[model samples]
Structures are given as structure tokens and as C-alpha cells.
Target: MVDFTPVPALCGGLLIGAGASLLLLGIGRIAGVCGIVGSLLDAPRSPDAGWRTAFIVGLAFSGLVGFALAPASVTNVANSPPALVGAGLLVGYGARLANGCTSGHAVCGIGRGSTRSIVATCTFMLTAGVTVFLVRHVVGR
Candidate 1:
């Protein structure tokens, strides 16, 4: 059986929107994680890299804090932690290759009236649905 929490989902969406809007309104920058990380790596001389690093660090710490508060909230599937980390790295690379993460493309991009973002968001949704279906039905592993 599956466990779904709509409240958390909605709250997360709202936070993402607020964060992206804050970044745009205050710093005049896009809240795309891949872009921010890439820029920090490739353009280390840029002044704005500090805030970007802080943002990424905060993101990492949020999960740690969440687990500290409610350890059960975290899940461990078939793979080990190292395997999951490798998968995450691959996904991050894929997101960069695709030019944006789901939050950046789906939430911020769509809200900004971007056609490319719209398509990218739709693609993300469709791919997610297909992956879930295949994992649950076809594989049954």
C-alpha cells in the first residue's frame, strides 16, 4: 500500500513558490538549483556564489533536521545509502542536462509564464507517472 500526504505536498509547493519568488524579487535571479550549483562551480569568481552555497547547505540541513525530529519520516528502499546517493547524483546530473529541476521548471518556470518551462514541467509529470506505473505494475519487484 501507498502512503500519501496532501498537506505536506501542498505546503512544500507553497514553500518552493515563496522561496523562488523571494529569490527573484530580492536578488533578480532564477531559483533553479542546477543553474545555481553550476554557476557556483563554473563561475567561482562571481560574488553571488555565497548566497547560492548557503541556500544549498540549508537544503541539505533541512533533511537532516527533519530526520532528527521524526526519523520515521525517512524511507530506505531496496538500495543502500551509498547507492541512493549515487542515484541522486545521477538525477542531479540529468536535471542539469535537462536545464532545470522540477521545482525550478514546474513551479518557478510555470509561474513566470515560460513556454519552455511549461513543456518541461509536463514532461516531468508524464515521466514521473510512467515511472511509477512501471515500477508498481510491470516490475512488481
Candidate 2:
């Protein structure tokens, strides 16, 4: 069973929202990880690449800090390297197809009252729920 840690979860959510809001307010960019990474990869020499690179670096740095602060909270359920790679690829594809990730659609876009983002976020949640149900119940994983 999943451990219920409301305080930590709430803190994390607040941090994410703050970060997203800061990015939007500071540079007028949505805090979408996939879009940032993709744009950086596509045009490393672009003028906006600096912020994108910093954003990616900040993400990595925050993960490291989180691990350092609470090593026990980190969990790695995917033991297989190939499985991890496949999952990453699938997620990238899905994000590209959807034109945004959860952070973009559910957080920043929804905050901006975007109708398309609302629909996309709903689809994302529904798909995630169905996938989890299939994996845990149907596949007995």
C-alpha cells in the first residue's frame, strides 16, 4: 500500500506551483519540462536556451537535494534498464503527441484558464488511471 504523506506532498506541490509561477512571471515561459528539454535539444544555440538549460539543471539539482535530504523517500521500482528506457521513450512520445506534459497542462495552463489545457489534463488523468488499473489488476504487476 502507498504511504499517506500529505504534508510532504503538499509542500512539494506548493514548491512546484511557486516555481511554475515564477518562471511564467519572470520570463513568460511555461514550466513544461518536456518542452524545455526538447527546445534545448532542437536549438542549443538559441537565445532562450540559457534559461532552458538552467531550468533543466535546476530540476536535476533539486532531485539531488531531495535525495540528500530524504534518501528513504526515493524509490526505484523499475529494476530493468530496458524497461526504464522503454517507459521513458513512451512518455516522451506521449508528451510530444499531447503537445505538453502534466506540468504544462495541469499546472500552468490550467492556472491560466486555458480550455485546451483543461481537456488535455483530463485526458491525461483518465489515461493514467486506466493504465495503472491495467498494469496492477489485469497484468497482476
TM-scores for candidates 1 onward, in order: 0.81, 0.92
* Sliding window of 10 residues with minimal summed lDDT for model 2: 72-81
Clashing pairs in 1: none
CA shift of 85, model 2, Å: 1.8
Off by over 4 Å in 2: none
RMSD of each: 2.5, 1.5
How much lDDT does each candidate structure score? 0.85, 0.89
lDDT of 1: 0.85
Q: Quick one: best lDDT, which candidate?
A: 2
> lDDT, candidate 1, residue 69?
100
lDDT of each residue in 95-129, candidate 2, tens digit only: 87788898988988898999989999999899989
Give residue 5's lDDT in candidate 2 (0 to 100).
93
RMSD of 1: 2.5
